[model samples]
Target: MAKLFTPYKLKNMELKNRVVMPPMCQYSVDTKDGMPNDWHQVHYISRAVGGTGLIIVEMTAVHPDGRITDQDTGIWDDRFIPAYRQMVDAVHSYGTKIGIQLGHAGRKAEDANPPVAPSAVRYDGEGYKEPRALTTAEVEEMIEAYAEGARRAVEAGFDTVEIHGAHGYLIHQFHSPLVNQREDEYGQDLPLFGERVVQAVRKVVPADMPVIMRVSAREYVDGGYDVDYITEVCRRYRDAGADIMHVSSGGEGPVGAGGMPVGPGYQVEMAAQLKRALDMPVIAVGILDEYEDAEQVLENDQADLVAIGRAMLRDPYWAVHAAKALQAEADVPVQYARGYRH
Candidate 1:
């Protein structure tokens, strides 16, 4: 059996394979209520039936105004727990572990009358609104929001909780020197906000369930932080109780003099660096959709897990196909077994 198919355990979460369906926003909340409707459930459960080992649900806002758009999901209140629990129970029936990425869009909140960020910097995009700097009290409030979100995720019976600190969101804005220009403690210490978020999330979650922190390990903006600097930032997150780092790059925008790398496994080396630097498990993402490309990451020990975003979006049965291609043992759904034969 290929190493990718081998059972891998992180904390108390045991995955049947190394394949991870990273969080990708579906923007399906047409009702503007931030509830995970039937569409969201079917979207994820289909992948669960397709043989994915773990599925990280898309960015779920920790606050109402923290959404990128009205269509994104939010879990700011206790009312969302029952609905999330319903989806979680169904996904579990397929023998797959599921998690939710708790995030706040911050300056990227398109509908916000005035988006909030660590600083008053605009996202440098046309549709984005200029953001106001978060006051110290509001920053503290956001931290509590993250904790409450995790508490709700626990109630929903999610296997784990991932803090979406990547992609220039609220947490990312606080950590990025390019975006954060505050004079307060948060500005003085870039990783402070993210570290506090991890600590807060760690408090609400079970001791055995690992806290995953997804971060942009490398920024694409010309003056953005490099892999080494971001690695150190992630080191603080690890110390703050983040058990795993979901390594991804870019999202700060504008291709710099050094362009963003494209093609297969481009971010593998960065994930490998973080894994070595932090000495903890890391999930590598970035065009790693091919079966062999995903396998080699595990085979060569570049990362602990590989995330396939676009590929999984295109085919929910991706994991099943990869299992067949690699000739590895996978729990193909009994209903679909006949369809998977070579």
Candidate 2:
């Protein structure tokens, strides 16, 4: 059997295959209320029909100001639960597990009234304005927003929840020393923000529901957190109740400073390194485009799971096609079976 078609278990969740549709911002939601509309339903349902074992929805904000785009999905209020529930139900109907990526954009919040961060540093050239420093009380509120978002995710019937701690977002800003220059508790310690977020989310999420931490392993900038630092962060997050480490790189310091050079499985080594250093499951993402590449990552035990982003966007049926090319039995939809024969 092809390694990519093999089933894997993370905590209590069993994924039918290693093919995961990583979260990609659609910027397609209705801006009026941050609700999932027909566009989201069609976009996500297409992936499910196309045959990905796991489908992680795009970066969903815990609060309105946390959005990367005005059209991004939001789980901040109970009103949004029904829309997500409809989408989740649709994805599950196709026998695919669905997960949500919950996050706060911090200083990167893409509006005039962006939320406060640990510092006032602007993400240079990323079009993000300098944000005000969040007061301790406001920080506590943001933590509650995350916990509440997790609760709503449960209500929405998602199989899992992933905390967005990478790509120089709100949590990433707190983790990078270059961005977080405060002398307070959140900045005096490197892992303070991440630790708190994990702990808070765990408190609200069901114990059986896996909470994955998506981390940017290498900041890829001077004075930014490197693999060593991220490895340590992974260890700490595991201790704080993270079920898996979804390893990806870039998005620290200046916009382009941490830009990861694109190539096949470019960031797989980060997952491989973290797998060696930690006892938790590690997911390798970025530039994973083919069956052999994914097989190598799994066969070598570099990553317990493989996540595909842009490639999956290009071809939602990539997983089923890869399974066929690799000569593995893939669960292709009956509607498309005839095309596969030719």
Candidate 3:
């Protein structure tokens, strides 16, 4: 049997396979109320039916101002629970475990009235404006918001919850020295924000529910943090109750600082390093879209799971097709079984 189709357990959660559908923002909430409409229902359910082992819903904002765009999903209100419940129910029917990535965009919130960040600096690029620094009080409020988001995620019946601490979002802003220039505790203790958020979310979820963290292991700019710094950050997250880490790099700033080498399985080594450094399970992302490559990562113990973003977006059946290609047994939906040749 291929490692890609092997069962992997994180605490009490058991995924049927190593394939993970990492959060990729759909930005489909047309009402601006942060509700998931029909588009989201079909978008996520199809992947569940297509044999994805775990479907992590996209970056869901904990506050309206936290949205990267007006269209991003939000869990800020109780009313949004039912919509998410419906999506969860549909995905569950196909026997797939589901998770949601809770986040606040901060300086990257292009649609915000005025974005907020850990510092008053503007993101260095067009399409991004200077953001007001989050006051210490507001920072505390955001922590509670994350806790509330986790509570709502539980109410909606998700099996796991991921805190988006990567990609230069609010948590990343606080974690990255280049973006965070405050003299307060947040600046002096850079990983404090992410650690607190993890602790907050962990408190709200079921004791057995796994809390995953997505982190940028390496920033692509000079003076930007690298794997060594992020490993220590991951240590903080683990101490704060994070069960797993999803490894991805570069979003803290513009990517022009001697671009990272891009290719298949480019980020696998980072995951391997974190796994060894922290003795924790991690999800290896970044171009490990091919089944063979994903299987190799698992077989080599580089990561516990593999996340395919662009490939999964292009084809919801990326997992099902991979099962066929790898000649591994996959629980293909009964209705679609006829399409799979013997």
Candidate 4:
């Protein structure tokens, strides 16, 4: 009876509900081969059984050096495809659509021998190592790598693929002038890197397979870009073939007085802004945990979808719980029906 449980169609993938299980790294790849092992299969399949509509697997690396930790899943090689196929098949069996967040951690790649970024500056926090500036040639290669990873995702049977451009990763590094201090084309055109990556990814996947781009709508640090600039960048991404924008905030640098408020639906405004600017479906994420709060986001037209992160991590059955709390039809598994009987 709530919009949160309504079926929403994007491209060819139709979600059973608007509750999205945003990617949270499991860091359980014991082989370091970037393949999803039994842990990954169980982790994601459980969410499907728990009734999440769209489950985007953790930030999977496009290259080995792109991983934040060596344990992060990857699609950098064809060998990873079969493993992903197994998980995709398992998740889909529960009527849940699956996707993967393909990204390169860049300077944040703690496991890399010497991390790379658009510039040589190290991240400004503790435990961050200095990074080398990616050569012009390497930049081009990274784009191709993203395309290839996307290609692999399709082969692995994903309903969609998300480009992890948010949270100060490689794509975010290029979008934010605070980190992209180069003399070349990328520096002159900050959003060029993201646009190119989007275009590259679009070229590799099936035309019907939706491409979602996660973006930081506002940077918290001084001199960093704001919602206005990010809206423009998102426009470019939309033009470059992104179907949805996963709107988030901060992570470019340290927070300041102007940063986002610490409360529920804090970043919903950013998602609403992007939806208005780009005229595209947008996912709002950031502390939106409560069923009523999530419903309000949709009721107010703030976002097309609501991503539950920490809450979903705490309770895999978050969607089911929210459905019951809101008096909507809860998508409980038949095998568990006895537990829900009045």
What local lDDT score does residue 230 receive in model 4, on the 0 to 100 scale? Answer: 91
Can you give the TM-score per candidate against the true fold?
A: 0.99, 0.96, 0.98, 0.98
**Which lDDT value does model 3 have at 222?**
77
| Candidates' C-alpha lDDT | 0.92, 0.86, 0.93, 0.93
Clashing pairs in 3: none
Can you write out model 3's per-residue Cα lDDT over 44-105, one digit (the tens) per residue? Answer: 99999889999999999999999999999999989999999999999999989999999999
Candidate 4 Cα deviation (angstroms), residue 252 = 1.9
Q: How do the residues 48-69 of candidate 1 rate in per-residue lDDT, one tens digit apiece?
A: 9988999999999999999999
Least lDDT summed over 10 consecutive residues: which range in candidate 3? Answer: 251-260
Name the lDDT value of residue 91 in candidate 3.
95
lDDT of 4: 0.93
Q: Give the per-residue lDDT of model 4 (tens digit) for 57-153.
A: 9999999999999988888899888889999999999999999999999999988979999999998888889999999999999999999999999
Give the runs in model 1 whose Cα sits over 4 Å from its true position: none
* Candidate 2 RMSD computed on C-alpha atoms after optimal superposition onto the true structure: 1.6
Native-to-model Cα distance after best TM-score fit, residue 200 in candidate 2, in Å: 1.3
Deviation in angstroms for 92 in model 2? 1.1
